[model samples]
Target: MWYYVIPALVIFGVVHVYTKSWLYILLRTWRRDLKALIRFSKVNYYLLKWERRNMTVPKVFVDVAAKHPHKVAFYFEDDIWSFQRVDEYSNRVANFFLSEGYQQGDCVALLLESRPEYVCLWLGLSKIGVKAALINTNLTGDSLVHSIEVASSKALIFGSDFERTLKDIQSKIVHLNKYQFNENMSLSKTLFDNAKDLRVCLKESPIDAVTEHIQKGNLKDHILYIYTSGTTGLPKAAVITNVRYMVMAVGLNKMVNVQDNDCIYDSLPLYHTAGGILGTGQALLCGATIAIRKKFSASNFWKDCVRYRCTIAQYIGETCRYLLATDDNNLVKHSVRAMFGNGLKAQIWKPFAEKFGIKEIYEFYGATESNSNLVNIDSTVGAVGFVPFYAKFLYPVSLVQCDEVTGEPLRDSNGRYTICRQNEPGVLIGKISALRAVNQFTGYADKVATEKKILRNVFSEGDMYFNTGDILMYDDFGYFYFKDRTGDTFRWKGENVSTSEIEAVISDIANLSDAVVYGVEVPGAEGKAGMAAIVDQTRSLDLEQFAEGLRKHLPVYAQPIFIRLVDSVELTGTFKLIKRDLVVEGFNIHVVKDEIFFYDVRTKRFVPLTKELYDLIMQGKVRL
Candidate 1:
């Protein structure tokens, strides 16, 4: 009896230790991968069925509407749009477009604000196999004209709200037919000579389903073209196929456990992939209700969530940081249990969730066109996603060693790309296969642009993979963490420095409202020198305390050599930092209006950057 009892105790001790180890986390992640695959199999079955029937999103939406006709599909400000109403409205749009002689494969440019009609119009156009180019509403002048011309749009459909914007670019876009729809139900004629009133046409059009005239297309057909942010350069139109839309919608819905009863509060612009596809897809594909906001209001975010009784919320870029900076007195107990998006920083994750009473955070990582998508299902603190060692074959995603400067994959003597070891930073790539929807890369509308993203002969003779252009690392637990973008991570003092990591630290130390970090060229520096632009609206930032904090929290090499203080930071529509202009102006006092400072090695403090110092730095007289 003594011998048997001793053996049992020893076994119990071993089991407890195993459960506490990283191996246990890896095992749980494997279980999660298996369960996710099992759930995704259902999506594949429907995709196959839809492909065989040659059905697109509109057809699938019709089936969903039949089951839940009276369900509230969208909540926009003071109005509620029911499934039946949206379905009928979309049918009217389809009929109206058909009457205009718009055939399958024709392209139309859509420039509209965030509203239910945006989704309805796109869905309606998709019915006739006409792909809608969803242009960024914030674009103006040359950028706006280039977006339309790049897509080769035959027609431009815009809301009356953008009439002024259209009038400015009317000369450039005069070749294309234009249609303007009134948001308010008033019968109004278009201001442009070539533009027509789409609202009036829609009112007279039949509301009956245009099933007979629906285009004969499969899941692989292009339905929409969502543009990139254009932060670094001009926006590129990424092709969104029916299958890609469904995959994005279903994959996120199933993994995050979003239900039909959930109401998602989306304040993001409607033209983006996060807002247009993922947010609206919940309502169209999963039968959930979406609450739309024209623009993000950090002060009113929580109030709106409570008002809508939303079960889920969406955010992107620095949205979470802005919310955290807002006054807490306005926040109230609400029904939002989950918050999902891509760019929540690790420093504010736990605090934001706890303060807002959020139960789960589905932090995800993916580009508008890349097939390399990831989501943190279990709410791991800093993890974007997880892929266990044993589950690599199933996921088809790997981290490959690459040149930090150029982001090109490094090949071994075998002429094959080498996989990064655990805890090593590498660029993430997803194997592309035409056979599976999950692994397919639909790519951009430009053939040359699309080809540039595909890395051929990755591991074998003819294997192809989509380069994600993001640097990431996985720990021993198989939890992946986002390091930085390929071009954003610069080397300094023989050490690779991540701009995002430094930005997070600066934001925390200085109590800054916003911060943008980048690398700038110094005359004598071997690599790019670090520079940080911080927003101090009230001019309350204590430089001494900030310097002390940085010294304590960050390594000596990772510290920013130059600092620029601005009243505010310029951001893209999605709240992403616009660094192109800032980077170009880089520590040049003559070009930059903002106050600049530099770290003095002897003084061990930040000192005002005078013209003499700037000249010295440029002449290589001052050591960086």
Candidate 2:
């Protein structure tokens, strides 16, 4: 006993002496790491209880409703719905679907705006094991028909707001049933033969049949079809399972630290995953309220937050810019303390927070179909995801070296992927192994597109991984930052330029609401030349100022050689910048409707693209 005590005392004295020097720093770091680990475990432990039970989104909502019956579940412009009320409404919707001959595994197309009824209708369909194809309400014509056809929907349920678009494509849509929400009985009876008011649909009493049907379904079953933003091409129908929705609900609630009395301010469209699952579904899961807007109004954004008493909000990359563009002084007075979503630009993160008094911004990186998902819980500016060193072994997310041109993972001599070194940009990939349930990539309904996302024989035989098309880089601390989309990165002057990075810079310019950066082929030039299509709201396109800002921020090669100023730029329903049309239109003054300008190297200012300059550029005479 004496020997043991003496040795312990000696060791303690030595440790105390070490604490006086820099050696004490290691212990502090260890303590901080331990705290983070405990916090992560606590959050996951609560979520795991439901994940183990295989609880679906509808089931979770029901549970919350049972717990907080009188609590406000949803808030629209002038309407408020209690949790119990919405739960009963969804039950009526389930009964209505069954009465109309809907069955398990049936597909229904939903074209509606963000409303309390819209959410209840979808949740009701989910109760009866029906997958709702969330079509973009902005879509019409052939695109709308194609989305419905691709989804193989048996029914089309639309809102009265989109009655005109529905009527235009009414004949083209080959669905077994067409139903429209008879809001105020304004929708024409001739347009849609089967029209039912939302109130009339909610007349049926809540029944046990819905709960029993939901209990019969498994976690792996498809719950919804979320379409990708067709910015690069036509949208693909991504299959979302019950388990995935559960993950979104629980995962977001935990990450954002949602409170029971909190109200979420969500202006994003419901058709997208961010607005649908992460926004509304999260609020339902956590027994929190939601303030949904019909459409995103930049001017009314702050006023709505204060009006609804919203403590949380959802946003995309473009959301902050629009809010910042407004001059409304109401931005400072609000209950919004935190926000959760992806696509928040690094340049706007600090300003957006300081201006609006946001305490936390849970920026994230994920797609509708990809299994690779990560969230930045620590509010690190510019970081899309975080991978703590202690959890790195458990997390399968990784960056792999890929071909710059083909955007494919590079194979080694044994046909194995080479992991990207720290601080090097590479395409992010996540392992999909039977050993890990969280890594399952349930992909799209189209088998070909599903297979296209999978990479085989990576790292080991029979190994598979999900390829994320975007490039990312992680620091030694495991903070991941987005570089650019694989296809969006273009080579110019023998160097690669990230379109997203450039767009972020341009988006930071005052009065420039939005920008789309792309590469266009230049005659005799080594590779594609950088071009920008910008939305100038102020109509004060000072060429000297714009060029000066570009020079200060970007390198000569990375700066746009041509600038096209448009009154409005096209965007996907999810608020992502669409560059396909801009890329196709290029800087051709003859074909383009907007004003085009070319960078004058000699004067270091942009000059209007005239016939002589266009000819000079086409003939390789211009230095640009």
Candidate 3:
């Protein structure tokens, strides 16, 4: 009897400790992951089914249209387009392309803004096994030519809104056929040589469904070429296969819980992934309605939501901050319950949510070409996503130690990359496997570019992983947080300083509309010194209060050594800050016309960065 009682008591004690310790938290995380995985399995099932049937995106969309023909598919500036209308319009586009002798594997360059027709054009081309190179509409001159030439596009399609842009590059792209789609019935008397009217062609073509036998592509074939944001260099076209499109769409749909009745307000550009694929995918794949805007307007953001009865809205980069700057009149009343996208900083997250009465902020992190993706399902502040410690085998994403400068992984004595410990920042990588659509890395259209992103022999011999080029950290609770880009984090005063963190701090302190931080070389310094460019159109920022706030929020080493005031910050179409030009200009007063200031250690204030001080710093006389 004593032996039995002692064994029972021991078992009870073990259970108690396990439940009381961090293992209990791990259990909850595992439960959350398990639930998410179960939901995601549905996407996998459809993907597998679609692959087996050799069905493409257009085919699936056609089926969805048959089911919800009368439902509103798109809402664009007082114009409502039903599913049936969109489907018929797409059919006419397909017939027109086929009539023009565009065969299977042909490439067509599409330069259009955010509109219902933009989606229909791409969907139509995909139906005939021709891929649409979704060129960024903001691109001009050399960049625009490179985009068109890189894809080996056989034809160019331009919206009437960009007729001048087309004319600028007309001579450069004369080798290819061009078509112009005019919103208004009025046609230009002076059309570029070899350019035809796309509207006339569509009107002449029938609106009936394209012949089933004419559709000649599988789920694995490429459907669209979406370009990466050309922040560091020229935009690289990322291959978007039918399978990849389905995975991205279905994955986001399930994770965000987008219902069929929900109307998604999409003000993002149509050439990018967030707006082009994921936003329109709600309607094309999940039976939801989409409200498309030509461009994102912070002032009219909520008003559009109210007008369209939008239940979900999309945002990226500095959109939230821009919205926060606006007055609270339209923000308070809206039907938007949830907002989804990436780049929602932690500083403004709570304020934006509370002010707008948003119930959830589904912040996510992913590159256009990378297979790795993360979403904060539980609305955890500052967390991009999480993977439980016990569940790493299931989701093969890891943070590995790497060279901070070149962003190359550092291998241990055994020649295997070392994984970072808890709360330690490292380059994020994801294992690539061809066994499933979710794990596959479709990569860029250029083979050299594609190969550069693949990291071979990562954890084990012959194992490949996609280098995400982003630094991230995970805590004891398994919530992963984005730190900064590899090159964006610079070593200062023998400590690594994250520009993103410092930018957030500066933006909050100065009450700035935008802030861009970068590393600039100091002549005698061991490493680069931190510099910040803040948007202050009126030059009304309180320097004294800003310096005080910086002292309170950041460490001495993490504080920016120099600051430049700019009237406006150049941003990408998606609102991401462009730092290439600013980095090159550095802190030279001659090169930079803007007002510059430097931190004064002795005075404990920010003083003007004069030519004398600049020369002193360059000559290594003044310490950073």
Relative to the true structure, candidate 1 reaches a TM of 0.78
> Which segments of candidate 2 are over 4 A away from where they belong?
1-36, 185-190, 194-209, 229-233, 328-330, 434-437, 488-624
Residue pairs clashing in model 2 are: 317-343
Per-residue C-alpha lDDT of model 3 across residues 485-509, encoded as one tens digit per residue: 6655665543346576677667777
lDDT of 1 by residue, 423-466 (tens): 89999999999988789999888887788789989999999999
- What TM-score, over all chains together, does every model reach? 0.78, 0.75, 0.78
Kindly list the per-residue Cα lDDT of model 2 for residues 464-562, writing each as its tens digit: 889888789997667899886666567564244667667877877535778888888776554578999888866687778888878755656678999
Name the Cα RMSD for model 1: 11.3
Clashes of 2: 1
RMSD to native, candidate 3? 11.1
Regions of model 3 farther than 4 Å from truth:
1-22, 213-215, 229-232, 487-624
**Of candidates 3 and 1, the better by TM-score:** 3
- How much lDDT does candidate 2 score? 0.77
